[model samples]
Target: MSVTGGRVPDHHPAHHRARGRRGGLSPVPYVATTTRILRQLAGDHRSVAMIVVVPSAIIALMFFMFQDAPRRPGVPSPFDDACLIMLGVFPLVVMFLITSITMQRERASGTLERILTTPLRRLDLLAAYGTAFSIAAAAQATLACVVSFWLLGLDTAGSPALVFVIAIINAVLGVGLGLLCSAFARTEFQAVQFMPLVIVPQLLLCGIIVPRDVLPGWLQWISDVLPASYALEALREVGAHPEMTATAVRDVAVVVGFAVLAMGLAAATLRRRTP
Candidate 1:
């Protein structure tokens, strides 16, 4: 407030303080948002099923598909090799779908607008979303990895714990990317549509189906930049090495960098308008 004019100018300290209050973080709002999101997700049985059941089902299906395939003595089963990476990829895809659609629904239904009217800063809201979904992602990855390693006989030459950790990170990466992409979608259907555009290309180029070195020069360059490529590379490293190597560490770092970048972009793009 200005003493003389009865209006605070842009240069006024009071104006700056008020702005900081509106934009600053508050633990109360952050915890409330996280709990509210978790409660809502719990009530949505289909989303719960997607998070808990879908990834394991996919892994099971893949296991059966390769159950009887021939392999030379002392050789790793092709399924084991694929399953290591798929464990990460499956949760990632599922979390991406769930996160993007859920955010789109919130935007289209005016929930975001109501939330923004509160004391919740945009960054706090996004951080809460990240925390909530990352929990879901961790559960999703754990279940799938358990089913793969125990029930399906999926083998890894490396530490299974490391594989599990990477799987969770991959799922978190999906959540971040999903949040970023949801900002551009006005409808759930459009959010779904982004999966093919954003995820499918990375799938084809992520060195799962073909060796990345065998890919064309352009494709190799493209793969080098996709987060999924780094994720797969890390998983393959865990599958082939009994211990974590520098390459795996580097790849995981790259994936984490991309995830953080996506979260930052998502926060920047958040809006109070109902879509």
Candidate 2:
């Protein structure tokens, strides 16, 4: 029974030599699942345009509108921090729009049932969608950041790394929220309807048009609960300031909390359906 190094003999019936070949085949499912989702995304032109074009336009428009705004003495330039904040928010909008469409389209065509019958897990489905969204969102965010920096001549005092991190987290949070919305949405129309409710409140409360500290007590409390609020704050602090602080930690925690909570909700909803 013993072989070299005291290992069990491969001659055992249960230990078929062919089993070694199976290890190479295990990755097939992962590759197949990834390719299937990518192909699905590739076939949809509207989704591609939505993810790529709309967010870019929004970021460009905001940059032009605010590029010349005057900065108060002893304050960071709006061109620098404001553009980045918009970059963070832009991805959220894109993800929301796309997620709504994705779920609604599947339900409309009754393709969701067919997908569920496959070997894919609920988490896998969620993850595949998230992966596609993240790739698109990251591209938009990066392009916006670069174009804004060049056009506005904005400087983050050489803290490009910090800006990149904040932008990515913002994109991830957006995609997570999108998945959660898609899970509960009954139709594409209903999902589209959720955008204003999900996006506009963040726009007002995220300190883009108004200073957070100057808001009324209750409004400030509401802003405190928003994911965009944390992203905006964290980005401003890291981009404009000379050093990091405990405040950065708190802000990051808030952003991460939002991403985790939204993704969890989406996964739970997907798991309840018959597969």
Candidate 3:
């Protein structure tokens, strides 16, 4: 259509092809970014000890305290069940703490802003953070449980594999929520403060100390909306009953759904540069 052109080419084909592509979430950037984060974390021994070693040691101590408690021939003691639940809760707490601080540090250091200057999308950064921490969380869950059951002689009705899976889900939930929370913090100290605002309430309300049913109606309804409630419930069900019941499956689904929601929220709130 141009005056100097012998012929004009239609752009419809290119546009049509681009539109035909699914254009869903991409894996290339996510994988590369996750690999880099994991490599960086691997070099920090103190961080490694805090994440994987300290929790296991605490659980081992709990086992030592209850090692001689009397129990039924095939059933675990009440303390054992509590320990099993802690195996899930500890990882969730640690992952949330570590992820929030890491994200805040990156933001403070301008690393996240610099990375955004490249081809990385906000979702890519969230995914990488989630994926990398999730792997570390899984390893921690496995090691903690192995040490508890084999070395410390801890007992639970659930299969060890199921506990591991639930722990991983809880940890991922932590990671996603941590990333979302980091967006609200102006400093790393603010991120640390969130443990009380975000986690302590969940711990108290998630039936760790008391039964959710026995709480007031208002309290029960509040627990209904918190992802930790479902996670703790799932852990209790597996630890006490060791069955893949409908309730257990539903709880797991809700926990995972919250994780996805948190990650989506983080991505939505992300900015190309600091405001």
TM-score for each prediction? 0.92, 0.79, 0.89
Give the per-residue lDDT of model 1 (tens digit) for 38-75. Answer: 99999999999989997789889888888899998888
- RMSD to the true structure for each prediction, in A, is 3.0, 6.4, 3.7
Candidate 3 ranges with C-alpha deviation above 4 Å: 1-22, 70-75, 272-275
- Model 2, residue 232: what's the lDDT? 82
lDDT of 3 by residue, 1-275 (tens): 33375644456565544443335545777799999999988988887887899889888788777767788887768567868878879988999989988898888888998988766677777889988999999889988988977887766677878888999999999998898888898888998899998888899999888889999999999988999999988887887776676888999999999999999998888654345
Cα lDDT tens digits for candidate 2, 12-67:
75466346334332344445665776677778878767766666666667667876
Q: What ranking of all candidate models by TM-score puts the best one first?
A: 1, 3, 2
| Better by lDDT, candidate 3 or 1 | 1
Estimate the lDDT of model 2: 0.73
N/CA/C clash count, model 2? 0
The 0-to-1 C-alpha lDDT of every candidate, in the order given, reads 0.87, 0.73, 0.84
Q: Best TM-score goes to which candidate?
A: 1
Better of 1 and 2 by TM-score: 1
TM-score of decoy 3: 0.89
Worst 10 residues of 1 by lDDT: 16-25
- Over all chains combined, what TM-score does candidate 1 have? 0.92
